[model samples]
Target chain A: MSAPFTDAQLAAFLTGTLEDETLIDAIEAAINADPALATRAEALASAEPMDASVREAFAPVLDAPVPERLIAAATPRAAEVVDLAAARAAKSAAPLPTPANDTGRSSWRWPQFGAMAASLALGVLIGGPLLKGGGAGAPEGGSLVLASADLTAMLDSAPSGQKTDLAALGEGEVVLTFRNADGLLCRQFLIEGKGGTTSDALACAGGNGTGWQIEAYGRRAAPVGEMKLAGGDAAPAVVAAVDAMIDSDPLTGADEIAELGKK
Target chain B: MNPDDTTRQALIALIPRLRRFARVLTGSIADADDVVQAALEKAMVNLEQYQPGTRLDSWVFRIARNHWVDDRRRAHNRMGHDDIGEMLDLAGDDGVAVVEASAEARMVRAAVDSLPPEQRDVVALVMLEELTYREAADMLGLPIGTVMSRLSRAKAALAKRIAAEGTVQ
Candidate 1:
């Protein structure tokens, strides 16, 4: 039997749009009976292309610190509010209206950007999240994180196993220490924010004292409908980045102190 | 919240997904953000046309797709923009086999990039964006059959190209 099914028919089968009942049944039967045909069917099914990686293809962008300019552009002013510039100015200055009330959802308050980071918006269209002094900032833009003085000091003196509950920034714990290829020291840390917001972060020494460049950060998955942009896939992305830079076993006690002192 | 505020919050939430779609359309992260920025500005200008309670992502995606065609998608062969290949490593850090798969995914993306503009639009809208043929046709102002034809042809071409890549490696 010459089973001459056109690509459209197969695609329709994949998309569940094939109109003919007989052909649909036949294709389903064939797909069930033949493994090779099934594989080809999935590939041709463009609705979810690339082995169903459609949802994941550009996921990195989802976690990249949103450009503030784009945020301004996306915000729509009221009917009488014709002054877009003024609207954007107001939007950025004030925290966005509070997220879900009393339901105990993740409180991702729109963080205020430090003045220096705000100025960078003009020149950089794809800059990382310019976190305020106390928020858990995203770690992407130019691969540089703006750490607060306290955070930097902690990175400098905090022990590998110690956890510090910081106000507004969340509870931070230094997980381990390692040396990058530059022979400079790096440390992996975890931040557990109030209401269950968790960040697994890595920072390396260098980029000037107190710069404490955040190499990568991952938020533990928050529930999807919480109005927060959770980079659920970030943990692996951060781990992969650290793995590339990781050389010797993580430092302990005295060894960690020696590395920290040099930084 | 007021309507404008509601719309603002909703749009903010979608920023990530919109940026993701823009990346798919533009390939490079830099270029993709440019498209997203343009699309957002355009979307805000035409805000009244947006119907609340409808799919905001779809509406903005329509806007973004239109803007992509009119503006930067055709911007001089995408020079100076960061190469998207570096950003395509969404596949997790496994061993060598995972890296190879990611490399192949990049090759597939390149193949998609090489497709003719019209076919590329059909693929982006129907296949990658998961829009229905009717929706895609409406957005492109073409007949559903035309969208289907383009999709079929594009799928065949991608299959052929991907097979070649698999063998080459």
Candidate 2:
């Protein structure tokens, strides 16, 4: 009965910008009546999120090393210090690597800055099963090995300042506690694994409250004797991830105790 | 840090998004990088002109779009070809993983690439980059109503082309 909606009206309806409720009802009624209109509307709605796929296609570019040419171009230089030809020569001599390959699974191959390279390592090392490995009771494939369910229990229940000897599981302690942007409580721990390998990890409370999701992690050689430093000594990637995701600074000693008390 | 240093850092952070926008606009990675390089240079030289509180990404995006338009004009004059031919060339050369995507995905990409330059620009900013319509209008120096109309027409055209392909398959 109602006049068929125009393409613009249909588009507005799809984008949720069409505020006319009466018109929207009319359009819906029309669409229900007309199979062709329904098919077109469905196609448009499905195609709308194609941007997500586009973003995914380019996601690797975010982790790729920022090209030296762009970095140099962005760097501020005084007039007297400018040498345009030399910069051009350097750019041409060391061209940035291309992003594509035959199989199209582009590797992170560019010469990355120290911090970004460390972040790449952290992402590669901890991104898969380790992050999803849940808490101590999580299925086997997790990088962290617990001595007993007790250590897992302690990790789940330990307060920010609670320092327990995890030597039986792996020599380390739960060093810090804070909340992430999502307001989930998180713990940072340093552990010495087999072969004197030290790893630092940040784990946030999983949704069900029974486990944790490892948000960031890194591994390096352990110091000869001393326990690894907590804040400053953290891996660059780990520190950066924490700084980005943490809602605020690590809870103060009293605040941490109070937080633990509530749990 | 000085204002230049701060702006430079911000620009560095924005490079990935800018590159993505450029790829969509130019429809080729090589041309997209060239556009990005030129725009970054222009923005850096004129960093003092950039206001402190405004959205820096929008400003740079506008610069990139302007540079793209200029390059298109020059290419048109040099080759004695119309914009449609150039757009077709770009669609053919869209090297953003044609081999890896599904046939449907490639079809959608090609359909987008085949849009008119004005429509394609609007789609890239509003759809791909997820800019608000008002922001896109501001960046493109068009009225908001014009942007919505162009986007409406572009989406309809893309849907039609994709449907035709589906039917053929």
Question: TM per model?
Answer: 0.44, 0.43
Supply the TM-score of chain A against the true chain A for every candidate structure: 0.44, 0.41
Model 2: runs farther than 4 Å from truth? A1-47, A54-66, A78-263, B76-105, B167-169
Residue lDDT tens for model 1, A115-159: 355324211211222322222223333235544554666788898
Q: Candidate 2: global Cα-lDDT?
A: 0.58
Alpha carbon lDDT of residue B61, candidate 1? 82
> What's model 2's lDDT at A262?
56
Per-residue lDDT tens digits for candidate 2, residues A174-231, read: 7667887677777777655444455667666664544555555555433434532434
lDDT: worst 10-residue window of model 1 chain A: A121-130
How far out, in Å, is residue A123 in model 1? 22
The models' CA-based lDDT, in order, is 0.59, 0.58
CAPRI verdict on model 1?
A: incorrect
Interface RMSD of each: 10.3, 11.2
In the range B60-116, model 1's lDDT, one tens digit per residue, is 888887777766433547643335445434323457875666565566676776677
Model 1 residue A42 CA deviation in Å = 16
The model with the greatest lDDT is 1
